[model samples]
Target: MKKAKTISLNVGIALALFAVFLVPAASATTVSIGSTIVGEGETGVVSLMVNDVTDLGGVHVNLTYDASVVNVTALTNSDFDSKPNLYKRGHGWVLLEGGQYESGLSGSVKLCDVTLEAVGKAGESSYLNLTDIDIETFTYPPTDIPIDEVINGTFTIKPVTPSAKVVINEFEQNPPGDDSGNEWIELYNNDSTSVNIGGWKLINSGGKVVTIPDDTVIAVHGYWVANWTNGSLEDSNEYITLYNATGTEIDNTLTAADGNNDERCWARYPNGIDTDSDNDWKYQTSTMGETNGVPVAPVDTTPPTTNVTAPPTLWPGKPDETTIPSGTPLPWTSEPVQLWFFRTDNSDSGTGVAYTNLSLASESVADLVNVTISNNTWTWETNLSKGKNTTVPGTVGEYFNVTISEECNATIEYYSVDKNETPRVEPKKNLTVRIRFEIPFSEVTPGTRYTANVTHDLIEPANEGKDATIVFFAETATIDSKPYYVLDINKSVGGTEMYVGINETAENFTMKRLVMKNKTGKIMDLTFNPEYTMLNYPLWVGKTWTSTINVSGTVTYANNTTIPINIITTEIEAKVTGEENLTTPYGELRCLVVETNAGILDTGLSKPITITAKYWISADEKAMIPKYQSYINGNLTEELVLK
Candidate 1:
C-alpha cells in the first residue's frame, strides 16, 4: 500500500487538509470535535468527525477554542480523509476544509484529527464550539450552496483529578524523521472511570517538565498519548516521570528509548502490565493512542539489498538497462517522453514483504500531462499461477494515496510522489517491481524543459538517485518563525545520475559528502556544502527578504580527474506584490503574488538577473503555498496550478 503523506513541522497545516476527492450527497453534514474533555496541561488529539455525510466534496470547519485553554499544534487525517491536510488556525478560530479535484469521501468519516495542548486553569470551563460549518460539493457544476448536518462532537473541559490512577504505559524517546518530532508516550488509566488530568506534569531526565492542559481525559481502562516535537522525550539514557497537580508522583523511573527507531516505538504488551524492568517494555511498531498493537521488532538491523535504476535519458531510454551510467540528464529536452524504471528488494528478515508502495511527485508530470495507471501485480499472480489481475480499470488519481495489492492496483493520477512502502517479507527472498510510464515533456517556456528529475521512490545515496519521499521539495512549511523547504539535489556519477537528500535537522540543510562520477565512470565521494538556507516562508505583501547562499560542489567529467568543488556567494531577494483569485482543479481561491529577482540562485552558483513569479497565495492564513504559480526566469521555466 502507498505510504500515508507525512507532514513536517516546517510545512504547517495548509497541506494538512490535502487533496482527497469526496463524492456523496450532503444530507446535512454536521462536523465537530468529539466531546472536548481535556485535562489542563495535557497534550492530546481531538477528532473532527462527520455524521450522516454523503458524497462529501469539501468542508469548511470553523470553530473557536479558548486560546487560554487549548492551543492546536498539528492536524492529521482521520480514516475517512486522505490528502495533505488543508486547515488553518488564527484569531481563535480554525478553518478546516479540503476536497479532491476528482474524488470525494463518503458517509460517517472522521474528517480530520487535531493535536492540541491543554493550557487552561483547573476547573475552568471552555467550549470547542463549532461556530460555522460549510460543506460544499464540486460535482460537475459546482455547488456554491453548503451542506448542513448535526455536529458530531461536544465540548467540555474538566479540571485535574488529584488522585487519578494514570500510569506511564509506553514511551519512545526517538522514532524517526529529522530525529526531533518522533518521540511519544502513552498513559494508561487503571481507574474505574474517566479521570480529568489537567495541570499535571511529565518530567524528563533533565528535570524539564511541561504541564498538561485541560480537556484531557482517560476513559475506564483507556489510554491517552503525548506525542509531538514540543512534547518529545529525550533520545538518550534518560527517564520519564509523571506528576500530578500537587506534585504527587504518579509514574517514574521509566527509561527512554534510543534515537533511531523507525516504524517502531516502545510499547507494553499485556495491557497495563508493568514490571519496572526493560522486559516490561518492548520496542515495536507504534500504536499511538490505542491498545498495545501487535509487537514487531525494528527491521533496520540488516539493510535490505536494494538496487534502483533508471533508463538512459537525454533521449528516452529502455527499461532493462543494467549498468548505472546508462541514465544521464538530457538537460535540454522539453517535449513529452516516456520514463521507465526498475526496483529490486531482497531481505533476510522473516517478514519478507508484508507490503510496499510508491509515491510520485508533481514535478514528474507536465502541467497537463494525462495518463493511465494500471496494476500489473495481479498479472504476476498468473505467472506464479495465482490466477489473474484485479481486472479493474486503472486510474492515476484514485491510486494516488494508497498501496497497490492483490485486490487493488495503482489509482494515482495526480499529486507528487510515488513513494515505496514495505511489507513483511520472507527471509532470503527477493521481490522486484518494474514500472514504466509515459510523461509529456514539462511543457514550459523555451518550448522545452531544461532540468528533469527521473522519478523514483526516494532520493538518497544507498538507493542510487531514487527518492521514495522527496523531502527537499515535498512542500513548503513554517518552522520556528521562518518558512523552509526541502529539495532533492541530483548529481552525475560515472556518466550516470545519482541523488542525495537534505534535511534541516541542525536547523539547516546539512550536506556533508558529495557523491559523483569520476572520469573512469566510477562513483567518487567529495566534500560538499554544509548547513544552508534554500527558501523561506511567512512571506507577506510588501515584505522583502534577502538570503546569501554559498554554491559549492565538485564537478567531474568523463575523465577520472576531478576538480574540487567551487564555493561562490550569491544574494537572493524576493517581494510580494499583490493578491490573485487563483483557480485550480479544486476551485477558485484568492492568492498572493510574490516577485523574486535572483538569477544566480537558479543555477545554484549566482543570483538570477531577472526572476519573476506570481505565487497566487490564498487570502487564508494557512494558505502559505501558492495555489497557482507562473514563473519566468531566463527562460519560461514552470507554470503550474494545484489540483
Candidate 2:
C-alpha cells in the first residue's frame, strides 16, 4: 500500500509540472516611430514608443536614417526612471539604452524622442529604421520580451515657394522702323512685393539667349525691359521662353507671328495678366510704359453749339418755365432762378461733349439802389438811377462795419465807426466786391452742342430790375454700352489742374477717370477699372456693398518725370450711414450719407493704405457729391473737405 501511495504522489507531481509548463507568457510588445514632414531647413521630432509592454525594466534601441536627407539633432530618454546608460550617435545611426532603478514599467510608454533637421533639397525623403532592439523584464534573471511589430517612420522635406509672382508681360519682336536696336522684351512683377530676377534667362526659338545681369531686381508691380540690339527675335513663327535663376521655366509665350512692324506689339490686356495661353496676349497699340489698350485718335477740335432755352419775356412766378418772352426782365424775388440751355455736337459724328462749365457773370440793377441799416441788418432801396450802394450795420462793440458804393460798379470797404470799440473781423468774412455792368460774351473754344440746368438765388434784393446772363459748355460720351453725359470739373492745386470726370447714369453715379495736367502740359491719366461707384440706386439707410477697384495708368509730372502706374487693387466697402438735409452751393436738399472705406494695395509700400470718403447724394436732384475725404498711409494723413 505504501509503494502504491508513493507512486500516486509522483504522478500527481508530474501532472503539476505539466500544468505549470502549459501556462501562457505575456503578450508581445510593439516599438514604433511615427512619420513626419518638415520643410527644408526646418526641424522636427520623432518619438520612439512602446505598446503592450510587460515588466519592461530595460530597453535598447538602434535607429538608422538617410544622412543626406535629415540629420539627428538630439536624443532624449523619456520612460526610464534614470538617465540612459549608453547613448551614442554616428553619421547615419543612433543607439540608446536605459533602465529603471526601482521597479519595472508595464503597459505602454515612450522610450525616447529623436529630434532631426531636414537637410536635403525639396521633395527629398528619408527613412527612420529601427534595428537591434532589445527589451527585458525585471526579475532575478532578466528575460527578453518578444516584439510582435516594428513600425518605421518616414521624414520628408517640403518645398518652399515664394508668394510673389512674376511673368512676361509684353514683347516687341518687330520694330516699327528698324528691327535692330529696338527688339525688346518686358517682364512685370505682378505682386505687391518686389522680386529679384538676377541671372534669369530669356531664350528665343532661334537658340538665342539673353541672360539678365547680376543684381537685377524688379520693383513691386513694376517692369523690366531687355533690349536686344542684335535682333535676336524672329519676325516669322516663333516663341519666347523665360527661365528663372535655377533654370526652371517660369513662363512662355505661344507660337505666333510677330507684330510685323505694324506699330503694335503683343501685350497683356490688363497688364501682368498671364494664364499661360493665347487669351492673355493681344496685338494692339504699343503702350510700352503704360496701361495696355487700343490707341485713341486725337479728339476733334470743333466746339459744341449752345442756345438759351429757358426764361420767357413775360415774368412768371414759376422757376421751371422754358420761355416767357424774348427780352423780359427777371423778377425780383428771393426764390432760386432756373437757367436751361440746349447743346448738341452731332456735326461730323462728333465725339460727345466732354464737360460743361457755367459761370455767374454779373448782377446789374437798371436804377440806383440805396441801402439802409437797422439793428445789424441792411436793406436795398432804389433812389438814384444808374447808381448802387450796399451796407451792413455793425454791433457797437463787436463787429466791423461793412460798406459798398458804386456808380455803375461796386467797391467794398471795411472800417470801424465807433471810437470806443476795437473792430473784430473774421479772416474769411472780409469781402471785396467788383462788379461790371455791360453784358460781356466771348467764345473760348468751338463745340457742337451744350445743355445744362442751373439754379441760383439773387438774395441781395438790390434795385428791382436786374439782368443776368449764363454761359456754359456741355458734352456727352458713351462708355461700356451706356450713354453718359460727361461733366468735368477742373480744380487747380499747386500748378496742377485735376479733372474729375463724373459719369451720371439713371440708376447711379460713378467716376470713370481722373486727369491731372500740370502747367507744363504734362498729363497723368488715372482710370478706374470697372468705374468707381459713387452712389447706388434704391438709396436707403443701412444698405451696404463691396467692390474691388483696380487703378492703373501713367503719370507725368511738371518736371517731365514720368511714372508707369501698374495695377493697384483696392477693396472698397460702402454703406449708407443715414439721411440728413445737406446745404450745398446749389441749395439745401435732403441727401443720403454714404461712407466708403478703401484699402489700397500700394506698390513699394510695406502695408496697404486706407482712404475714407463720405458722400452726400440727393435722390431728387440725382446728384452725388463728396462731402469729406481722408487718406491714411504709413506716417501720413491727408484730409479734404468740400466748402
Pick by lDDT: which candidate is best? 2
Give the C-alpha lDDT of model 1.
0.47
Tens digits of per-residue lDDT, candidate 1, 298-389, equal 45333222223333552345454443232223223222332332222343332221122223223222222232322333111111111111
For candidate 1, give the lDDT of residue 58. Answer: 67
Per the 3 Å backbone cut-off, how many clashing residue pairs does candidate 1 have? Answer: 113
Q: Rate the local accuracy (lDDT) of all candidates.
A: 0.47, 0.57
Model 2 superposed RMSD (Cα): 41.5
- State the displacement of the C-alpha of residue 290, model 1, in Å, after optimal TM-score superposition: 47
C-alpha root-mean-square deviation, each candidate: 32.7, 41.5
